[model samples]
Target chain A: MSPEAQEFLHTFVSESFYYWASVFMLLIHAGFLAYEGGASRVKNVLATMVKNLITLASVGLAFFFFGWWVYNAFPLFPMAGPILGPWTNPEASEAIKAAMPYVEGSYPWSSALGPNNADHMTGVFFFAFALFAMTTASIMSGALIERVKIGAYVFLSIILGGFTWLVAAAWGWNYFGWLFAKMGYHDFGCSGILHATAAFFTLGVLLNLGPRVGKYDPQGKPRQIMPHNLPLTMVGLLLIFIGFYAFLAACVIFLPGYEGETTIYGTPVTLASIGVSTTLALAAGLVGAYISAKADPFYTISGGLAGIISAAGGMDIYHPAVVMLIAFVGAFLMPKVAMFVERMGVDDAVGAIAVHGWCGVFGAVVVGVAAGGFPQGEGIPAINLGTQILGVVLFAGLLGFLPGYGCSWVMKRFDLLRVSPEEEVAGLDLADLGVPGYPEYATYEYVNEQLPVAQSSGSTKYAE
Target chain B: MQFSPLLAIFNPSPFQTHSEFLEVEGPFYTFAHQPGMIAFLLILCALGSIYFVYASFFIKGEQAGLKSPLALSLLLALGLGAVAERVYQQTLRQSDRPTSAVTRGVQMRSPQAPSPRLKPLALLGLVGGSAAASRRRRSSASRQRRIR
Candidate 1:
């Protein structure tokens, strides 16, 4: 093929690959909606589902306006004058500068944001990254279900999805990012950047938001708050498992002239490797959860996600057996972690902190242990253990926890974080949205009767 | 006068002439070059600020003192006004140029190029009009309750 023909083919294939990956990633949102909706009591289901929808819209718009620009502009942030300033690989930095050329391409007003004949990749690539942003926001949403004020949640979502995670990506995930260039950080599957960051962010919000009203007894002992529909939650997890494949696929790059695929770090990898490891990780996770959590359906399904996340950091590097072993151990430890978190007086409704946060950290550590001394890229330092630990602390504590905690703390001070106690007991859908998720059911009538007369005034109309 | 970063945000497009802008190739070429884009963004910022205030305060029934929202809205409006004034000046300058320059600018844009004023105006109408309509509904409902 001619050079031009090869370039065209590459652009077309790359565009189609990301576009399809984005389309399939929609299933992750669908899964989150189903999962959170089923986890909430009947009254809060619509409220739970609406938050997921808002996550998609808010993050999408935010990413379009500024999030993409942040990723492009801040890869070597705090060093303004020369692109090759301190702690950066000059050659790799130059290559990335040529590839991104953010000033010309990434601004909201840039022609690349529109239908420019000169650019074919920006829009689809932006969509894929935006979906990742939405996924991060959705991961936080499940942990705050039932009692969080919608407006407060939306504010936090934009901060996390649009701003914070992008900052983390600019630091750790980019080819010439300071973390990779200076510390040889590698997280091919975004285990630290996306999962751990969002999970830790959720932990911050949960600390301020507190447990649901009835989550604990007067004795301070935790009680079981059964999901409205366990089966629906399980199905949601299954869809998420499917969507995760696309998520992993988006992390790989298909260079135009190169014969094989590469991880985001430009290291050689294969789709077959990703597929085999992911499948085995899922099976191992399920078995581990089954044995550890005593066949609890919720924990078992959750283990599947924990499994992928625990092994995600090394998906491009780890052998199938290693992946399986790591995933199994992560899943086995997830319930214990959740119990530990709960013992510390934090109530995570969906084990999000455990599944995403704990497993994400676990995955990153495993990679450091397993792939230590591996070459990252030209002019970048080799991967090592200390940097991986630093990534966890940076991603989880500085980037994730501080912003999450500070923002929620402010919201809490203003009484904007959680719904009023009255509203929480009356159900968020009835109190806030003024519609029940299941108005046709007799349970609606029962709930209406259960409410005090003052709280029931406007809600009775729903029954009528 | 010292340059204000806030002022820079309102004047996003740097190109001064249609000919100068057309030298750049891409889709949405005209859209980005047009001064109206600045007004559109300023208006978006204004509306977003207003909505955030409304959602955070009014919807939650918290007493938000009028000052914060009022000041923010005023600042955003000033930004929009500046953009509009600049666009008006640019339009006047462009009218003095040769007709061929104008024709070339038009030709450079896609066939579906939107009128420069349409987006900001439409967005203003949608958000402001919806808020007014909802307030009217609430008032009528309260009036009915008093009557009953």
Candidate 2:
């Protein structure tokens, strides 16, 4: 094993981890499909499922191509240099091609692998971000579950997941992003970029699409749209929680490396910090949401997630006690805010507006004050509540909510947003699927065996 | 407006060289732009008061248990916020960060950066379009009732 083989091996393993994370994140999409399917009316389940599947296929492919490139390119393309600047950047581009990693003039993509100087984690790193992009799109899938057309929603998913979320990530989340470099804006994970942006975007779409036909009466009052299967929905959220952990874990650089002072404690970076804060936040969120909800299982689970969303921007540095405490606030706010949004006539079917969108804004904004006066890092500007709010505005309002609203307005104008009224009444699934998933669920044998008994009982009871 | 003033409050600064974007010096540091948990609590208290005062005008008939869907959604929102933040922190999520010590011009690279040509979108449009291309699920009873 030569030293060169070691570097190549590292790149392979890291890239593999990156791709596999997507495999794990896939469970989240699957869970959302099931969860949304269950939440929908019986007539609309399959249609909802199709919406989920479409988001996955479309968002994945979109990100794989230019989606990933844009993230890489935007970080410093014009700022860093020129056309091939991103491609040739000594820092961020492909290390193998530049360095001639293995044999000179003979490599995978080209004759030489780029520069050999980098630690070799860029591809895996981008893949991780791409996965986040997919989740952002997937978030919209859940909110617009019952009404959005598969085609229309799929188109929307590509825009939200592939383009919108990436732009936010570049602006707020990326270290080299102008936002991070200049604004001192910080989002440890996507409080704004992923969650908030998706939430607002969903709100935008819902505004134009309107609720499922009967969601509101002619009187403008909202109705109770129960999940067709509460237990299944619960199960779906549990899967989301489990997979969400992966989504969160993928946001930080976790691979082992040596920073001076050798000892883990002394090293500026440690997975332990993330681990501790995450735990504290989860516990706090769980308790806070559960306490408020009186133990409603659905809210309990979703609140737990919201807690994390609201505090995600600086989870990496908050004290454990503070982390738990803030998480409680996160949990406390998520529901209250969402309910308020709903009351305002903005229907977010799965609370996407509240959980991801509003909460994301809150979380991003929270960072400005939470770490106030602290050095944002050299050359990264000073912290300001106003700036943080602006970041939230840039991401949630401008890039996310406003644009989302604008898109919906346009979509509505073009008649490309949702199904017609008749279809909504019949149920999108029934119109889409040739047959309903359930026919009272009587097995062929059971129906034969039980039908006669039922008939006999009816006759006897009536006769008596 | 200055971006970091507010942002700094929430995600204030830490020590890092121009080169080391990926390093964190300590446990999660609370920022200065916004109130810490204590201030947030005060705000919540204010909000609670407002909520209570608003409800004071409501008749007794309006008070209800946790069964309403709106109530349930509110509850879910809170929980999901916590969970999303927690999940992000707990996972070993990372992006590429060049080391501070590595002299100028030394950074990692990736395999052919993902290309954004028409191919990827075509695939998504094709497969995802199938979702649109899919057969609409129908209910037998509705179909039968219509036929009758």
Candidate 3:
């Protein structure tokens, strides 16, 4: 084939591959919405889905307008400096322009519009990465399900999806990034940078938002928030794991370098190696989480996903046996963490804090032990246990937990966090959407007749 | 564990004792495999597992899915089989066959082009679909409550 043809084929195939992969990833959102909605009682489901649906739309625009740029420029750029300097420069190279969003014209797709190029492939590449930002933001939506104002949470997603994650990705995820080059940190696919960060962010909001009314008894005992629909939540989690494969693959450079052969098995760099690790890790996690639970549907399904995320950073190098062990550990811990949080009076509506935050933290730290070190060699911050802890502390604590909790705390001071007692029992949906989901049957009477009081705290009613 | 006394009689260490059984490879396994099989298997496994979990958990009522499970299992098996074959090919083969061309060609390659935005357009579709989902969920719940 002509060099030109090869280039075209490469560009066409890469672009197409990414485009379709992104479509599969998109299934995760629909699954998340359905699962979260089901986990939520009907009174609040419509509202919950609304929060999830608009998060993508609102956060998408936020990411387009500015989010994608932050990932490219923030690594070395001082935070206090001008945000647009590196990203929006009109003089950027063609390769850079070819990689951005909202370009109507061509070449050097202005930093304003994101880069563009004939030979370069930045637009879709940016999107491939951008998909992660969206997912990370969505992770938080479930935790703050019932009473968070739709507008407030949607706007929060813009910060998480468009700004915060991009900064962290730029700082930690970049190959030549300052943190990577100088600190010796190695997070293959953002166990700390993405999942852990988002999880803590959700916790911050929940802390300020407070637990759902009656989440604790008069004696402050915790109650179980059984899923309104178990099947949906489990399905949602599985879709998340499937989407994770694309998310993982997008981060890896599978193609051979110039003038070298791609190795497999004994030769090394085999695609099968990656596959085996991923599958075994997932299977192990599923088994581990299931065994721990006496047929607990929610935990078992979530365990499978926790399995993958835990192994992700190290999957590139781990043996299949080791990967499974790590996965099981990741999955089994989520429910335990959830129970701990409940005991502490922290109301996490979904297990986001455990599934994403706590497990994400473990995954990052585990890489140091399991891989024995990062693939990148020395001077990188990730090799040391302290640095991994630092990454988690910064991403999950300083950025996510502290800010989230502080902001939520301030919001709570004005009684903005919780709804009225009547509304709490009544639900956030009716208050926010101006529509009651149930019409003819008296709401409480019907709930009382059908479900036990413990199962009947349907706290949002916009669906009516 | 009750068989431990029998096992202790056989060997002092278990980790180093795999020699008790003869070593052999699966018939289909080989080391010349590339990313094509791996990538293919990854796709099949991902989709299949998703289907299995989805049906097992979410699908309810009379419309319980039948085809999905079979389809999923087949996809999963094919993916696993291909991946296993590829792994064996990589590990057992000792040739310096310049495998990059094969693997890269199979799974990925150098930069040439990027596909245009299906996403921006898809976002429009999502917007429309989500609107419909919101309304449908509401009305269905109301209808159920009314019947009750």
Candidate 1 per-residue C-alpha lDDT over B1-148 given as tens digits, one digit per residue, 9 for 90 to 100: 1111111112222233323332333311112444455445445544543544454343432111111234334544764585466445544543444535423234222234344345335434533443454356566877999999
Worst 10 residues of 2 chain A by lDDT: A258-267
Error of 1 at A57 (Å): 0.8
In candidate 1 the C-alpha lDDT for residue A251 amounts to 89
Q: Order of candidates by DockQ, top first?
A: 2, 3, 1
* Per-residue lDDT of model 3, residues A7-74, tens digit only: 67766766676666777778778778877987897677677878888877877787777776677656
Cα lDDT of model 2 by residue, A234-307, tens digit = 77876777666666656655343323211111213345566676666666676556544445555667777777
RMSD of 2: 15.9
lDDT of 1 by residue, A355-379 (tens): 9999998888667654544555556
Ranking by TM-score: 1, 2, 3
Off by over 4 Å in 2: A1-13, A76-123, A254-268, A440-464, B1-148
> For residues B34-136, could you state the per-residue lDDT of candidate 3 as single tens digits?
2342343345445534644664563222211111233334543664474355334433341333334332114221233122122112322432343344346
TM-score each candidate. Answer: 0.71, 0.68, 0.66
RMSD of each: 24.9, 15.9, 16.8
Q: Pick the candidate with the highest TM-score.
A: 1
Clashes of each: 1, 116, 38
Per-residue alpha-carbon lDDT of candidate 2 for residues B17-78, written as tens digits (9 for 90 to 100): 33233354433244222235446544544554454356445423221123245544544565
- Number of the candidate with higher lDDT, 1 or 3: 1
